[model samples]
Target: MAFPKELYNAKFVEYIESLKILYLVDDKFKVICDDYCSSKMKTEKYKKKFEKYFQHKLEFENLSKELEDEILIYLIRKG
Candidate 1:
C-alpha cells in the first residue's frame, strides 16, 4: 500500500522546509542537503539510492541479530 499523494507531498514539503532551516544554520548541512536535492533528479534512481542504503543497514542488523542468538544459545548451554 502507498501513502496518499496529498499526505506524501505535504510531508515531503515539510521535510524540505525543515532542512532548509537546518542548512541556514550550518554550512556543513548545506553540502548534504545539496546532495539530497541532486539525488531527486530521476524517480527510480533516487528510489534505488534510498533502497540500497536501507538494505545495507538492515543487513548489518540481521548479522548482529544472528550473533546475539548464537551467544544466547552458548550461554544457555554453559549455564
Candidate 2:
C-alpha cells in the first residue's frame, strides 16, 4: 500500500528536519542523516562538504507495536 500523500509529505519533511546540522553555508544549511533517503535533492547540494555530525553511531532498534501507546493511538484515532 502507498503512503497517504499528506502524511507522506509531512513524514518526508519531518525526516529531513530531524537531521543533525553540521554547519551553515552562507544562506544555506547542511545536515546528515543515518542514511540517504533518495536520489531527490532537498537541501542545497553541500553533500560532500558536510561531514557526519553525531559522535555516537546508530544502534538498531526493532520497532514493536506495544511500545507505540499514545502517539500512534492518537494518529490512528485522527486517521
Candidate 3:
C-alpha cells in the first residue's frame, strides 16, 4: 500500500531499525518481535492495528506536529 507521506519522523525509523537488528542478533527479542507479529496475525483486529501502525511508521515521512506527539505518546504508553 502507498502510505501517506506525513506520518513518521526520524526516530521512528531508527527505533524500527534497532528492532530489526535486535531481531537478527538477540534471540530473546527476536522471539518477542516474532511472536508479536504472529499473534497479531491471528486475528482481524490486530491485523488492522499492525497495518495502520506500520503504515504510519514507514521510514520516509514528514510527520505533522500533532501526529508526532500522538505517536510518541502512544509508543511511550505502550512501552
Scored by lDDT, the top model is 1
The CA lDDT at 61 in model 1 is 99
Candidate 1 lDDT, 1-79, residue by residue in tens: 2222332344568586565566677768766655554554456687889999999999999999999999999999999
* Deviating ranges (above 4 Å) for candidate 3: 1-14, 45-79
Model 2's TM-score against the true structure: 0.15
- Candidate 2: C-alpha lDDT: 0.38
Q: What lDDT score belongs to each candidate, Candidate 1 first? A: 0.68, 0.38, 0.63
| Model 1 residue 53 lDDT score | 96
Ranking by lDDT: 1, 3, 2
lDDT, model 1, position 46: 71
Candidate 1: where are CA atoms >4 Å away? 1-45
| Per-residue C-alpha lDDT of model 3 across residues 1-79, encoded as one tens digit per residue | 2222222335447676575566678889766666665554566677788999888886336466668989999999999
Poorest lDDT segment (10 consecutive residues) of candidate 1: 1-10
